[model samples]
Each structure stands twice: as structure tokens, then as C-alpha cells.
Target chain A: MRTRSVVAYKGPSGASVEIVKQTFSSARPKPARRVSFLAGLHGDELEGVYLCFLLVQYLRRLKETEPGAFLGEVNVYPAVNPQALCHGSRLWPFFSVDMNRLMGEPAGNSLPAGACRELLADLKGCSDLAVDLHSSNQHLAELPQIRIVKDFEKKLLPLALQCNVDVIWVHPMAGVFESTLGYNLNRAKVPTLVMELGICLRIHRDFCSQILDGAIHLLHHAGVLNSSRRPRGEIKMPLVLKADQVGLVQAKRAGLFAGRVKLGDRVGKGDKIGDVVDPVRGETLEEVVSPFKGTIFTLRELPLIYEGAPLVRVALDGPDER
Target chain B: MGEAVSLYKNVWEKGHFVDTLSIVAGLHGDHLNGLHLVSLLSRFLQDVEDGRLPGFRIAGKIQLFPMVNIQAVMEGERLWSFDNLDLDLAFPGSSCGELADRLCNVLYKHTADSNYALLLDASEKRCVSIPHIQLLQPDRSLRRAARYLAGEIPGGGPDRFPGLGIVRELQPTPAFQLRLYNQWIENNVCALVLAGGRSAGIDPETNGALLANVVNFMLAVGVLAHATRKAEKGEARFYSLENERRVSASHPGLFLPEARVGESLRQGRKLGELRDIYSGETLEELFAPQDGLLLTLRDYPLVYQNETVATLLVEKERRWYWPFS
Candidate 1:
């Protein structure tokens, strides 16, 4: 029910790195439920940082009137990537390496490796569930959703699906199983989930709200909030697919490009996706085609494409699913 | 030539130390995907396409390699270094620019008269939290076509990051090459630019997919292929990365991925999961936003929080029938 902070580590320059924790919990023995969420793993991703900002603003105010009225703990730390955030980059300030990929390695060995070792040690020592927030950048647009790998599915799914998001991905494989904070929670047998909002290099009010509301709804489901804030829609179980093949379609000859498809459109197995035209030559270079039967997900935005630059991505369907 | 662990040393270091989920492993000449792609593209024009495209077959090929950050690549460092100054902040590339700039100049010269699409392959040790495709063009139609092309790449969209790209740096480069691609050639070839895939090494499938996508896209446009035709492989739901998506992991943990590139996904889908290599604690879950495709999947096990796990490119719900299925 209160905010908590712990020094995660110290920069070589000696600036203390801290784990800013926002907790909402009740007093008595097993008085209520609790939820924890963290964001800004990539310092350059400022949206989650802002969403966490939005969360703290409201949550802090709610505490005053209710006075720990919620059932359990609701903790949030807005920014986790300190160095990268300061410089507007994706990696840690000095390392120039990504922080997200090192979850599986030992702490001291990773950049920001010493991150809140003391704090996580303690949270793991007590916490029950956790969630991480993220935003998508330019080029890709998507609906917000929750991701719950297998082990956590037992406790997390039924409860996680309560968020306003659209689908839930349940994976139980090994590749998805290593080196992540959420993976750590599931390993500890603590239920956890990750919420993904597409593209946030800048803020999109709708996308931001989708993420914020989903988080709040999750809080309600977890019993962290005592009051009822009705969710807009029901969270559906996921419809999973395994992307099998990937390749690039190039321009046979150089020329101006005329794209025929839009994002999120369903394309037939052999539909015309676009065309290459020699502007001055007054002729068509080639007919860009769809290689498979699936939704057309993306296209290379640049018109002047090389002979082999990627043009569009086709999501292959299950042979029988179609 | 390498120790057992050195097969993917750069990736190992990045994956284990930097927290990079997936790595693009490039050995010696393999860093030439761009040239190879461009060459492949040049070859297909006369051989593959049945005379749909009208142009002189062999006038010239431009290799605009204007910027080669050899110091950075060799040292596993970022910020193109010359006598020892960073060049990313310094652009329009100087004629006498050292290391990176000179490399850029040389690159520009190679493609100085390319007369066609410009393909630039950039690989290094740096990674960003929010990743995207940087498109440069002044022409609206060209921009439109590229924007459509940009769709296949994740993170750069209207609802996403706003800027067109890290400043349109290609106009001059391509113009420089445009002159070259057109020199002595009856029909001038346009320049195409591309970068971004797993770094530190190579992901063959990702490379192949990126290549194949480009091929098919060209076919769709009627510039390369005589007709647009679907492959026998059926439709695939490749995960287009959510806006500028990057995978991250906590410190001091062994990172791993549960998903591979080109995997099908549903919203809330688990593309991969991570756990503590030592204690076996579950750390993170890499998921998909909606019914979409998976582009680049992580190949390594260890990770850091901000590292790119795998770019999970997603798409709207659709189904393609595979022969086996």
C-alpha cells in the first residue's frame, strides 16, 4: 500500500542506482492481494516510463482517500533503464549493448548487471506476482496484449486475462523460458505477465490508454484495488500461430514503387502486393507478388528499393488452419 | 579458426553480457548480405524476369559504402570513430572524413554510378531499446512506396514513433550514387536502402526471409517478376515486431528464447521465455501483440533487460494452409 525504494547498484562514477518501487498493499495477515509492474527496461523506450508516470499519479492519489483500502500490494517502478534514458538511446549509457538480452546471464557479468540485486533478492524473498510494461516504436502498429508463458499460466492466465487487452499468448517451450525477470518469477512459482503496446517512440493517446487501463484492470483482477473500475471488454484466450518461413522480395529493376496493400490486410496466396515502375522509362519493372496465403503484415516503406531489399512480410498459416 | 566457444563469440558476449536475445552471426565475408542481395537482384533482372522490366542489362553497379565504421565493428564499439571522433552526430559525411566518413566516401564511390537500387549492409556491436527502419527519400511516391515497404519492418508507424527516420541522410548518398547508377546507362536504376536484422552475427533464416520478402515484394510491384505468384509453401504469419520492439532481461542471469524467427503468434502469445541460468528462476516472457508474424527470433540464451530478444513482427489474423498440415 506504500511506495518502496532500494538502491539497485552504484555507477563507477558513484551515482547510486536505485530500484524505485510503488507498492499498494493492505496491513493484516494476508489482508489482500498484490501486483508488481516495472518498465523502461530499454532506456530509450520513454512511453512505458510515461505510462508508469500516469499510473503513479493516479495510484498515489487513490492511496489518500482509501488509506490502504485495497486488498494487497500494487507496486510499480516507472524507469528501469537509467543510463540509456538519460541519453535517449536503447542501450545502457556506456556499454552500447542491450540490457534485455542478458537476463539469463549472471548479474555482475551483465551491463547494469548489478541492477537492484539487493532489491530483487528481497522482492523474490516476498512478492507473489509481477508484470513488465513495454511500447512499440515506428513502423509497426499493434493492439496491446498480455503474454504468459506456461508455468505461470496456471495462476496468471485466468487472472491476467481480466485486463482489457485482446489476447493471451501461452508458451511452454524452452527458448521462451530463459533469462527474463518474468521468467524468474515463473521459476520462483510466482505468477507473472508482460503487457505489450505497439510503438511508443512517441505517445499515442489511445495506445497509451490501452496499456494504462489494462494495467489498472489487472490491478483490479489481482485485488490490489478495492474499488471497481469496469473493464471495457473481455480478454480473450489467445489464438496461437507459429511463424514458419521468412524471406525478402526484391525489385527486379529500379524505378518508382506503387504499393497495392495496406497494413493488417488479408492477402490471397498470389495477390499483387505492389509494383516497380521505371518513372522515366515509362514501364513496369516487375510485379511484386504474395508468396503465401496469410495476412500482409508489413512492407518496406522506402519506394526506391534495391533488387533484394525486403518488401513485405507474409504470416504463413497452418496448412489445415486455412 | 576459432575456439569452440568462439563460433559465436560476439553473440555470446552480447547475449551474455549485453542482454541481447537474438544475434546476427556474421563470419568473414558473410557481412556482405547487402552486396550479395544487390548482386542477386542484378542477376535476376535478365535471367528471372521474362523481359517485363525494360532497361540496359549491364551498364553499371554502384556500391555506395560511404560509411564503414571499421573501428567500431572491429573494436565492438559504437559511434563511428576516426582519428578518434564520433561521426553519428556528424553527418553529410565529410569528403576527407577519416574512418567512418572515409569508409562512407569509399562506399559512396563504389555505388557512385550504381544506376539502380542502393543496398547498404551495416552490422556492429550496438543495439537500441526502440528499434526501427530509417527510410530516406524526397519523392512522395517514393516515400509512399517506402512507407509501404516500412510496414514489413516493426515500430515505425503513425501510432508509433513520429519522425520519418534519423534524418533523411540518404538523398545525398543516393544522389551521389544516382549519378553513378545512371552514368553511361540508357535506363537509370533507382537506389534501395536497407539495414537492421540481428547484429553481432547472422541469422540465416532471418537473412533468407528478409531476402525472400524483398524478392517477392519486387515481384508484386511488377518491376522484377513478370507476374506475382504465391509460393507452394502456403501463407505464413510472420511476426512483425511491435513498434520499435526490443527484448530485455535482468542482470546476472542466463538468457534464452522460447521462440524462433518466423513463428506464428496470437495476442498474448509466448514467442519465448527467459529464466535464471543458475537458479532456474523464470525471468521474462516475450509475447506477441495480435495475430501476426514473427520476423527475427532470438538465437542466444543469456540476456539483459533492454536487449532485442527477437523482433516479433505480427500481423492481423489470417491462415495459410501448409501441405503437411
Candidate 2:
């Protein structure tokens, strides 16, 4: 395994935009399949960027010690949108647009546009399986999850089970489709799995290790790795959830939220989730209660909340299949 | 004089639950026109609530967020204190995001479910304009209702306020107006923005006109009983997005304006002039791109290359003042 850098786009001001890809591969005859992992499409989502680097380190050791333990080709795009990363903005700076929204647009129109173009061109025909890693926005912390278009569930569900994430979210069809990297690659017959963990602009080592381990598990399941690095636990099928009105709990008051329940915590109906407190008077304004018997899928990291703002996302627990 | 009551307070009150109108103003600290308008409304609504105004029936609730950005308002700055970010562009803010983000989310939450929302906005010190209504397009009845309210204002003929109303196709980004537009689409809140005047100084006429216009809008939206004093729809100019042209300086120099806001211009007329700041030699004459109304004129001169000098409203659709329609 070694590191490689390619100039994805050159800015008008002569600054070269690059994508650093760490590749772990076998030197022998053609590997079984090519899988790629990408992170930092949004500059602020740094969790996946760190995860990719850590995975690269693990892969390097695996290739050095047990060469046959790892099979096939694995490429990691540690940071895709460097301009946004440098500015700590969610979208590509200067262009002031979400690069994720213009993936299928003609490149060379602008810097970020050109980078998206180069990204698609680089990954085309190279990846049989693709995973786009991301973190939730700075406001909300999310449970480790795998998301795929709802239609691809049957084909990708078994593979998703191997990711070791806590939840499997089916992508809602309401949002932009063709403009996203996962959708574009999926349309091209490339199975792309979008994974999200933790919060944006920060690094969580535990989450990163879990994600890295999940990737290894998925690769091993694909017959690409022969390592004895067994799955951390029984590869249980995740509770597949859809974003709906039922799961969303909005704040009833505008104040600082003092949370009583954390992410991944299970609660019964009518359980106290949090309470909004008026910081000036130090009085509890309203108590937020859970409406279902479920596990918290997403929790607010920043306490300041407004009336009707989503306080928590709960994924209802289903009937036991044990 | 031992104790005093604060004029700056969150005075949100509810009347009969006929309709809910969330009136938000002063999102930016320095843009005081909105604050002034809110102040006027607070007094008027207080009068109506106290039964002081005869025949003025308060039909619905008025949620007044007079000082949405209080810290910024105190500092007299356009942006919130969090990283000096513009609150106007921090829409659909997050519950767990930064201060600006949470404020934005608060606004979104309040306005998302309202029957109607009125956001008051103003430019910073660089520019100024007459009080006018700005509507997001793809044409909803809200645009027509705003035009109706603009017509109802006291002193205005067909082309009176110059760009009396504007129809903009707002991008669905982080902007406050855009966030409100999203609510309009999903919840039918009929969101409208009353963007008028500029910072550095306040115009009483613009403030009064805005105050009247908001009241007129309440009547038109069925939040108040129709009265003879209500503004009648009249001949006025509505500028589409294309008509609003922001003319920037082509070269760095001293800029001299040949025309001010509310002035009409013919095609190819000199809008401004640029001269060498040091040498006092004529450099360039900025001309109107087309026949139009000057909506916003830059007050603070001393120009830089690419600095906006003025915004003209061209390619307009003007409605004639038909007294007996």
C-alpha cells in the first residue's frame, strides 16, 4: 500500500487542487474487484477524512505482514473538496455552491465543478463497489449508519449488514438524485454505499475505528480479504429506517436544550428525551418527550434550539426476529 | 425616575385565532429601518389591543420578533457575533449549530407553520432605497397581495416609489428569504419581505410607509376587517430579477453619481462618472444599460474596482393608475 496524489483541478489563480488517494493492492495478476472509499466531499465533514487515513495505516500493516490477507484493490480519497476544507465551509468556497449537488453537471465550468468532474472521471469504470463516507452537519451527532437508495436495498442489504453500522437508512426519494455522487455512480451500475457517522468538522477516534473495521469486514465478505480479522460481533442486520414524520421530534420551545438521553439510547414512549431551559432565568421552559419505543438515531450536539426545530431522530424498535 | 421600562422587549401577543402572522424585523443589528418599522407596529398593535383606535378590530395574533439578532443590533453591525456571519444568509439554521445557526433555526421554526410571515430587511450603509416590497417569484398570490399593499400606501401614483415592488427568484440556499420561501411552498405561509431604506441614517417617510404597508397587508390577508382606509391596488412598477441590475465599477477611481435612487433614466444616460482620485482627470462615464428606474444608489462614494455603485430596475412591468377600474 502506498500514497498517491493527483491534480484534480487547477484554479484560475494557478493554485493546483489535488485529491490524495491511498491505494492498497496486490502486485500479482489482476485482483478480484476494485473498491473505492471517498470522504470530505464537504470540507467540514472531517470524520471520514481521518477514517480514511487510519484505514490506510491498517491496510499498510496488513500488506506488509500478511500479503495474502488482503486481496483486490482499495483506493481512498481522503479529502475531495480541499477548497471547502481549507475554509471550513460546508460547500465549496468561492463558488459558494454544494459540490455534491453538481456532480453530474459538466465540469470545467468552475473550480468545484471541475473537481467533481475529475472525481467522476477518475472513479468511472474503476470501482465495482464504492463507499462515500460523510459525517452529519456540525449541529447534530448521528449514530453510525449505512444509507443506500431504497431500490437498491435487496442487492445491497446483505452487504450493508457487513458494514457493522448501528443503523441502515434508506435514502428518501424527495431530494436531488442525479446530482449526488452515490446516485450518479449507482446509475452507472456501480454499487455505491453512503455511510455517515458522528458530527462534522470534528474527529471521533472510536467512530473512525468502528467505520474502518466495518470497511474491512465488508471487504472480507466480498472475498477480497483473507485476514482472520473477524467481525467484531455477530453481523446483525441493522434496523432499516426511513426518514418520516413519525420519527422526527421537534423542540417545543426556544432555549438551551439540556438533554437527558444521548444518541443510541433506547427509550419507551413518553420517556423524557430532553428539556429546553431559558438560560437567562435558568428555568426549564419545556420538556421534550419521546413518542415511541425506539433508539435515538440522531441527537443534537449544540444545545441551543428554537421552537419546532428537530431535537432528536428516533428509529422505532421493531418486533424481535431473534 | 427611579425605575424605567425597557422599550426593547419581545412583545408577542395573541388575539382571536383567525390567522397567525409572524412579523420579524431587525435580523441585522445595524439595519435599523426594520427595527423602526417593528416599533411603529408595536405601538399600533398596542393601541388596537387597548381599544384606543375606534373601528380598528384586531382579528388575529401578532408574533413580533422585533430584535431577532439582539447582540448584532446592540453592536450596530449587520452580522451576528458568531464569526461575524450574516444572519440573513444563515437560514434554516440548526438546533445544534453555531449561534447564528440556532437563531436561523429559531426563525424557521416560528415562521414555518404560520399562516403568513413578514420579514423586514434593509441594506447596510453603502446603499439606500425607498420603502418597497420584495416578493419571491414563480408567482404566488403573495406577490399580488404585496403589490396591493404597496398601492395602499399614502403617497404613490403609478411610478411613484420608483421600484415600488420587486419579484425575485430567490435561490434555495441559506438566505432568510429563501428559507421563508421554502415554508411558503410547503406550508403555504405566504412569506413576504419588506426591504427598504439603508443603514447609517433612517428615513421617517420610508419607516412610516413600511409600517402602513404591513397593516395594509394584514387587511389584504384577512387578518383585519376591510376598511375604506385600506390601500387600493394602483399603477406601480414591479421589477423582475433581470430588471434589478447591480452596476459595479469597471476601474478603480473616484465615483461621482449623476443620478440618485427613485430617479428615472433613459437608455445610454450617464449614471455616474469615474475620475482619477489623485490626478482629478476624467476616467470613465458609467451609463445605464437600459431605460429603467434607479432602485438603489450608493451613498458612500470613494470607489474601488468591481465595487457596486448603484442598482437600476430595468425591464419592468408597469401597471397604469386606472382611477375607475
Candidate 3:
């Protein structure tokens, strides 16, 4: 595996800040199909970063065991927000701008500018495929999913769907989606898919491993590696849930919240997901309830509470858009 | 609901669109929002584009074009541009002003005509907040209507909505626009009413509902009687100009969200728990410390305790100014 660092910024520290890019299967290339993965643009979202690291390690070991494991080349930029990681944060320091949004902007134009020009140029040179890894900052958790821009299904869906995540988001140029590195590559006509796996803040071991498995599956599925991985079952595409129907119940008064729900429970209207109480005062302030009928996918585990803080999330079936 | 225009009348490349626009007087690109709303409202657009959006001559009322800010929209930003000239602030723009100012001038021209209502429809950027409609009354009836509009709309009214402790200071403040809408009402007076569904980038259904609220409001205020548009369920509240609330991550650490948008809670509810990436020591617990409706929760976790996680559209029945009696 080849790991090269692309300088993104030259700081007051005199040393240039570089994004580490790692590659597998470059030695005996066969009509090299370069599939690239990037992660950790937002300092706080860490799951994708873990996946990046795991995949790199996995590829390293696989290349040795089975030469075929090193089919086409896979490049990984494990940590894009090194500054954030250095401080244990999500966004690039000082700029605080979401780096994902900075993708595609010309080098040295914006805040940190597009200092990744040479790296991006090389990425364009390998315009076969690209994947940007990510996760929700907070308030949402789910099985790994893929977001593909509109009309790329024919060329990219098969590649994207192979990741083995639960849902596939099909849309045109969403906010973070459009400015993402994957999107920028796609704009250059490189087939691209954005993989969102697990939550941020920490690594969900199973979720993290899921991504590792997905990368290998992708290599096999792409015909680069002749692996025995099989499609588990018929792929399922979930219906998109709008933002509003999803609800969060925060506490009205302050207390310790003891949630009585798991991560993925079905929630109906008026479900008691948790409660807020003053332990010392020996009185309850409010009980978090689901206002609309939906399924509960994530619940806050923290006990110490405030007057108003989110406790539970419910995804409801929605009405017409307008 | 959004339209695109090239300020620079001629074709220009990305390299010099800015300096070039200044010279030749035009730039290209579209400033857009309401994507999630529009995608969700594909059916609604089918109605509008397919001629199903029925509207008759407003007797003598006027209709203005929507203003688009391409530059700001491109960067996935809410503000006007990198320099930050809000579309509202740059209104009534000078001929030689910046692109934002120029667009503002364009807006002033379309809206300058007397007797026009401005329904500024928007959404919370994250998710799980009330859909709000605002109206600032012109005393008595408008005041009553502002209250009523505030109450009638899903979220809150033109001004003085509960959730937003932060607000935009502009000429057509909700009441100002409300006054504009009712300018021809003679006795009713004009006012401003803003209704928001899902905030930017997240909830499409709520966003669609918010847009529908405006359309329904237009139908009602336009008094297209018997329009058959079902009234929305929630009431609109009001807030002051000083009440704009912003949401971001909490604790500058990785934001591992324990929930999705629109979760319910009691006071002292845990929104999510933050921990150090290496040490695993619990840092801060994101909690709801008040009684209210949550407007936004993080869709992406990675927070800084001070970072705005989720915002609540707080409504204390009495403390709030209920326009609808």
C-alpha cells in the first residue's frame, strides 16, 4: 500500500498540513481501476475515519495473502481534518468551515483554499470511481447508506449498492452532497458514491467493520478482485423520511433522564421513550413522549439533563410535500 | 418556487465571474434553497408548472418575482455571500452596489409597487422544529391578525416568535411585510408573516408543509374564498428581532447523535452524550433544559458543547404574544 500526504495548508507552524492518501494494488496493476475513499472532513464525525483506517489495514493484509485481493487500486484519505482531530474536533480549526463543502472549489480560492489541486488533479487522472465516507453529526443513527447524485444510477448504482448499507439516497446536488469530494469527482465524470456509515463521536465496532467488509465487497463486485463474497439478499431501498416528521423530545425541566428504549424501537404516538426527574428533589418534571407516530432509531443515553434537551427521535410517515 | 437568473447577461467562466460581472454587468448561476422542499413537493411543482396552481387576476393586487442568490446558494450557505450581504439587507440595492445589492434593487423593483404581500417562507436548517408563520400587525386588526396569523400558522408569527432568540433586522420585518400584504385591506393594514417547515437541507415533508402553509395563507389572505385548501394544524407564534437561534455541534468533540430530528423531551432531557475520542471520559451531555418544541437536532454528530446541537421552538402560552385571540 502506498500512503502519500497531500499538503492542504501551509500554517504559521512553518510545516505544511497534509492529508494522508493510501493506496493498495498498485504493484501489479491490471487496467488499473482506481476506487478512492475519503473520510474525516468534519472533525467530530469519526466513524468514517475509522472505516478509512480499517480498510487501509485490511487491504494491506489482503494484498499479502491473496494477490487477487489487490485487484484494482484503492486510495484512502483517512483523516482530512487533522487539525480537528488534533484538537478532538470536527471542522477544520480557525476556518470552522465544513471541508466537505470546500471540495471542488479552486485551490487557494476559499479559506484554506483548494490547496489539494495536485491531489485532486491526480484523482481526476484516476476518474474511474470515488467514495466519500461520512456520518450524521448528531440526532441521527442508521445502518450504512449511500447517497448518489441524480441520474448516475446506470453507471454508479451497482458500485454504490455493493457497499451493503441499508438505504440508498437518490437526489440531485444536496447541500453537503454537492460540494463533497465524491461529488467533485463525479462532476469530473468519475463515477462516485457517498457512503454514510454509523454515527459520529465514536466508532460503532460493528458499523466500522461493516464498512471494511463493504470495501472488500465493492472490490469483488467491481470485478477487480475474484472474492467469494455474495450479495446477501435482494437489495432494499428505504423510503426517504422528511426532516420535520422526525421529532426530538427535550426536557422542559431539569433532571436525570433514564431512557427506557433501545436504539431501534418502533415508536407510535405518545410512546414513553424516557423521563426527566430531579433525583434529589424526588419529583418528576416531564416524560419524553413521541408526538407523532414513527419509529425510534436513536435515543440519548446521557442521564444528566437540562430544562430543554433532546432525548428521543422518531421518524414519522409524512404528508404531501406542499 | 425558485427561479434562476444570470446577473452577468453573457456567458462567463468561474475563474473571473466576480471581476467580470463588475465590468460587463452580469454573472451566471442560480441561488437556490428549498431543494428538499421542492423535491418533496415534486407534486406541487407538477401543479404549478402543469397549470394546476390556480390563481385568478387578483382584481388589482400585484405579484412579484422571487429573488435568487446564486453565489450564496452555491457554497451551501444561508447568508448572501462570502462578504455576507443578506438578500434582505441588500434590498433596494443601488445600481452600482455589489451583486447582492443589485439583486436587492431587483427585489425592490418587483415589490416596490404598493399593495403587495411578502410571504417569506423558510425552514429550520437542521430538523425537528415547528413550522412557523409570522405576521407583524399594524395595530388593532393587524396586531390581532399578527397574533391570529401567529396562532394560525404552524410555527410562529411575523415577529416575536418564541424559538428564535436571534432574528434578522430588515425593513419588511414580518410585520412590515404583513403590513404590505394588507396594504390594500384599507382597514386590515399590511403585515409580514413567515412560515417555516423543515429547516434548510433536512426535512422535506415539513418544508413542503411550510411552503403549503404560505400558499394556503396566500389563498386565505388573497381571500380566494372556498379554495378548499385544508388549514394546517399548528398555530404560529411570534418573537422579537433579537430572537434568532443558531444550531451547531456541541463540545467541539465528535458529535455522536443518539437521536434523529423531531424527538420529544422533558426538561433536562439528554439529546446526546459526548465523550473524549481517546480517553472515553464523558465530556458533556446535550440536554433540553426548557419546556418547548425542538426545532433542530444534529443530523451529523461531532459536536462542541457550545456548538448549537438542536434548537427548540419554545412557546410559553402566556409569555408569548398570542396574536390569534
Candidate 4:
């Protein structure tokens, strides 16, 4: 096990922040393949942090118990934006800028941009494949899933299937995704997979364990770990989804939303999914319904919602599924 | 369909011309300074068109979009309340998208043929600023045009308005790719952002100075025939990203500002102090690193460690010409 600082910044008050990465590799001079795990890109997303912790613990145990099991290298970046993670903010506290958005940007005088440049340069060719883990914001709770842009769909779908997520969604690309770490890595031929699970600021142990198993399975499949060390269990096959096979439900009025459906519930069309009640007026302002027969992949976890706020996202399971 | 965003444009033209200048404001609902300045310019243009003003008259076409994001302004929010979408970042927008997107598309198309586009905006944070001009990746010709609009000779000194003296050349980042200024620049139009004041509030003196600056720019660019008053002159300062010194708080606490924006300060000047939220003891005091002009100061009290409390534009020595040296 080796730990190194990827980037460091000294503040005006004599304090400093550094992004560190831990590497575990075989005793041999060269490894078969190198795999990287990135988490805590957004400071509030804690699921990936916990998942990384679990993976690191497992790797330490495997390295001690079965030294021959490690055939390749595994790198874990537990927290990329340490300042934001410490402050529990979604953005870099100083500039109030989203560090994730600054990835792949040209190096600049700003600390955030400079840090991103260094991080990208370090991670560019360091691994044969990488996984960037994330969790939804405070407003929404997402089920375990992997979202891939359509341009990289063919190259990423097989790898994404290796992870035990609920759905593998291939959606059309938007301009905003061009600057993301996963998109840039994939563009650079590093084959990075973006995994989004659970919600921000909270950890779901079951989900973390599920992803931990999937990560180990991926390492074994990539020849980074011995087959004998693979977790004993059937890896769930995630449902493949396309952009059109998703339905979004939004609140029609501003009020407190009481969700009637769980995160992984299946419902029929026109089913009652939630109710937006106006507590002040003592009236149910909106009775949100499922737009299509599908499984709920994302639900509004926070009760206070404004008009036009997304309440739920459903992955259609019938004819829409391909 | 969502509620339609009505964009009102007031144009002043006296004769046929090949060049047209487009001025846009109110892209963000909270940027009321720009809105007020645009309104003042609109009324002034109307007077000139009606031959009510003594010396000024329309020479070329001048298009004034006083309020672009009407819904946001009505709600007193920075972004559209319904969608929470920033209209400023929806440039070259899609007609088939949301309300903000459609509005951006219409505005982009409407100003596609403009020779010069000026955007009126304010600080993105909860702070105030002195009226200044911001250029994003400006080319040589655009820089010269900006100087002319600022009422200064191509490389000469003595700016027309000290209130709008600061000119900051910004490097476009990924976040700026969707800005209207970037889109216009890509399309070969000279674009400039005239920003100052605070969001969601009005400063009479600042808006008045901004209005004067716009009028002078119009005169300099030949959009307006003549100037109504003598141009005010002062030395304009140009700064790049390197010239910016951002002072951040070292502790999380309630920040109490000791200085105001636009004030010139010496090195080690106290900018603010962070006080413990519960005990009310001074946690740390922030100071300016160099002699510079304060461009922005944090207005909101609550701040976390490493949060920027104030931004200063460092003053640099003027380059010595060969003969002068």
C-alpha cells in the first residue's frame, strides 16, 4: 500500500489542502492491469466515500490473507475535493465554483482550475479503466445506476453491466457532460464509467456493500484480482435503458410532498405516486401520478418542493424497454 | 406550454446604417442595476428620437433590451423561479427547449447581425462592485473597440469615466462557454460585459454613472450623433486574472466587513474580521495583500473557512516607453 499526494494548495492563512490517492499493487514489478476508483467529487456525496472505504478494507485483508490474489494495481481516490468535503459543500467553498465542472479545463491561476488540471493530468493514463462514483443531490434520492452518454454507449455498456446496479441508462449527450471527469476520461481512451447511487450527505450501507461487491467483481473480471477471491454470490444483471424509456414526474404546485412510492417500487400508469399538500392551506394541491408503467429509479426525498420540481423519474419496463 | 417570456426591444434610428449596437440587460432577475440603466437609456434614446434632447440624436441603429428575463424579474430571483434555470448560461439556445432556452434562442437570433453587443450584469455573489467593463478572451480589434467605447484613444491614457475605469480581461472557462458574450464572440461580434452594483437592489449613484458610461459609449461608437455633456476623464486600469487578489476567511464565522468596494487601500489594510458565531469573539482578521482597489466585498455575514471575503484588483506599475525610459 502506497499513499501519495496528487495535488496541494497552500492558503493565505498558512493552512494547506491536498488530494491524496492510495495504491495497492502486486509484489511483481509489473501488474496485468490498473483500475482506479474516484469518489467524493461532490463534497456532499458520501455514498461513494463509504464504498471506497469498504473496498480499501477488503483489499487490505486480501493482501494479507491471500498475497497471490493481487495480480494488478488498484488506485483509490477517496476524496478529490478535500476543501469542499471538509466544508460539506457541493462546490469549492472559496470560489463557490463546482469543481466537477472545472475538470478538463485548461490550467489557470485559480486554485480550483489548477487543482483540476493537475488531477486530470495525473489520472489521464494512470489506469486502464476507472470508475467515477457519485450520489444524487439533497433534493433527489437515486437508486444504484450507471448513466452513459450515447456517444460512448457501446464501449461502456459491457463494463457498466459488470457493476451490480439497478439500471444502465444510455442517454443522449448534452453540452454540460462534455466537461465531466467520466466523459473526459472516456474521450481520452481511458474507459471511465460514471456510477451514480443513493443520495448526497448520507450513506446507505446496503447500497455501499452492493457496489463494493460489484467493484471487487469488476477487479476480478479485469484480471486485477484472482478469481478465487471473487465474492460468492450471483451478480445481479442490471436492466438496460435508453433515453426514451424514462419518464419524469414533476410537481404541479408548490407544497410539501409526501411520496407514496419507494425508491425501487414498480407502478402502473396513472398510479398515485405522491401528493403535494399545502400545509398552510390544509389542502392537497397536487396528487402526483406515475406517467408510465415503470420502476421508480429516482424519488424526491425532501418534502418541500416548488412548482415544476422533479418529484420522480421512472424507468419504463414494458414496450419502451429495449 | 409554459408562460411565454415577452422580450421588449426599443430601437432608435435616424438614417440607414450598416452597423447596429445591441444592449442587453435583466438576463438574471436579481440584476436590477442593469435593468434600471437600460430603462434610463431607453428613455434617453426616446427623447433623442423625438428631438427633445438638445445635442444628441440617433446616428445609427441602437437596440435596447431593457428586460430579457421578465418572469425572473417578476419573482425577484436570480434564475427563473419555475425552472431554476440561469438565462445567462442558456445562450445559442434551443427553440424546442424550456422557457429560458426559448428566450435565449430568440434573443440570440435577434442579435446575430449586431456589430457590437454589450451586456449589463452584476456580481454573481451576494456582493457589490464598482461599475467596470469585463471582456472575455477579447481579440486585438475587440480590445481597441472596447477602448474606443470607453472613450479612450487606441493606446492612449485618460479614460472618460473613472466610475467605470476598471477593465478586466477574463479567460473563458467551461462554465462561460454557454454565456451570451462567448457565443457572440464566437460569431465574430465584439462583445463586452458592463457589470457593477449589487443584485436585487438599486444604487442610484452607481446606476447613474453606469448610464453616463453607456451614453458616452454610444457617442464614441457613432450610435448617438453627439454628446449631451462633456466626457469625464481619468486613468483607466486594466487587469488580467493574475492581477486579482482574492482574500478568503481562514475560519468559519460571521464576517463583519471593515472596508467597502471601490475603496483604494494600502497593503495590510484590514478588509474584514471573522467572529465566532456563538461566542462572538474575533476568530481572525483579513487584510489586503497588496496596494489595490477593492473590487468586491462579501455582503452576507455567514461564511465558512476558505470562503472569499473580498476581491482586490492589484495595482501595477505602468510600462515605461522607450523614449520616456
Cα lDDT tens digits, model 1, A1-322, are 4556654544422245566777655644574665667787767566678888888877777777665556776677777776667776665665554455444444433334446344445457556777777654333344455666655667877766666664455555443235456676667766767766555466657656766777777777666676643455654443333324322345555555688886556677678989987777677878988767765444555565434445665544545423
lDDT to native, each model: 0.48, 0.71, 0.52, 0.80
Please, what are the lDDT tens digits per residue for candidate 3 over residues A153-179? Answer: 667767766776655656554333445
Best candidate (score: DockQ): 4
lDDT of 1 by residue, B79-107 (tens): 43222223332223334432333433443
Expressed as tens digits, the lDDT of each residue in A146-256 for candidate 4 is 999999988889899889899898999887776678888888899989999999999999999999989998998888999475788888899898888888887777679
Please state the Cα-based DockQ of model 1 relative to the true two-chain complex: 0.01
lDDT for each residue of candidate 2 in A1-322, tens digit (9 for 90 to 100):
6677753444423245678777888545788888899999889999998998887888888888888775688888888888788888777664446677777764423345556777887777568898999998866898889877777777777778888798998765534455688878877788888899999988988888878888888888887777775555665467787654227777766778888988889888899988888878878888888877788989988786655657888887753310
* Candidate 3 chain B weakest lDDT stretch, 10 residues: B19-28
Q: Is the docking of candidate 2 incorrect, acceptable, medium or high quality?
A: incorrect
Second chain TM-score, each model: 0.48, 0.84, 0.58, 0.90
Docking class of 3: incorrect
TM-score of each: 0.45, 0.60, 0.46, 0.74
Chain A (alone) TM-scores for all candidate structures: 0.74, 0.91, 0.76, 0.97
Worst 10 residues of 1 chain A by lDDT: A239-248
In the range B111-214, model 3's lDDT, one tens digit per residue, is 44433244444543333334444444344444433332332323533331233222222223211222223332332335453434433434443344445544
Regions more than 4 Å wrong, model 3: A8-10, A26-29, A116-119, A138-140, A149-156, A171-177, A228-259, A275-286, A291-295, A298-322, B1-325
Model 2 chain B worst lDDT run, 10 consecutive residues: B1-10
| Best model per TM-score | 4
